[model samples]
Target: MSGSDRRRGVIALREESCTVCMLCVRECPDWCITIDSHVERVPAEGPGGRPRTAHVLDRFDIDYALCLYCGICVEVCPFDALFWSPETDYAEPALGDLVHGKERLGEWLGSAPGAAQPDGQSASG
Candidate 1:
């Protein structure tokens, strides 16, 4: 397998794929990930069916200042929401700006890689 696809500069988030499970935030040893979500009741499928609750992601932020770049969040994420982005130019002018919001993280999707297979091959391949 070719190693040209390696780009571990920064972590990016795929908001759509994320179920707000909080696994990444909880697994981060540096406590750099922060996620907030709200529960919404989904309508029943049919007559006499009961409604179910779904987690709506409200906020998901990652503070690069405290991040260890350990890739733990990407590994622990069961929903395949996080990935390593080749975007290393996201340097902040201020300390507070280092905390990237969900929108900002999603913007890096241009370079974010697809899900990888166990054999070091992209799932799409």
Candidate 2:
């Protein structure tokens, strides 16, 4: 696929931008996105500020086996955490292996924007 065609290609995740919000999970018609997280107490960044609880992501996975490739998850993500990747060479020997964990999902993150892709869209995939 061409670089400009990532919207219809595979999915990539940016873990840093994700807030552990469940919008993608709840909005997915196929319920393919899986995430594991917990709340942590974050100390105030400055004096006279209040501490707050934050969701810490422990695990995040996407089951391509169940995904419809409908782009719903990508579109519904409030943060730009979910984006499309033009790399389509992913193939799993077993169906279970299609459940891509956060690390694998993030493999293509370097190809996110300004970088060129295998499709030569940017200049990174």
Clash-forming residue pairs, model 1: none
Computed on alpha carbons, the lDDT of every model, listed in order, comes to 0.83, 0.80
Q: Model 1, stretches more than 4 Å misplaced? A: 1-6, 115-125
Over 21-121, each residue of candidate 1 has an lDDT whose tens digit, in order, gives: 88887888989988999999999999999999999999999999999999999999887888888788989889898999998888776567774544665
RMSD each, Å: 4.7, 5.0
Q: Model 2, range 1-125, lDDT digits (tens) per residue?
A: 86565454578887877899889999999888889999999999898999999998889899989999998888898777787776677889999988988888788666555334435554222
Worst 10 residues of 2 by lDDT: 116-125
Q: Model 1 TM-score?
A: 0.83
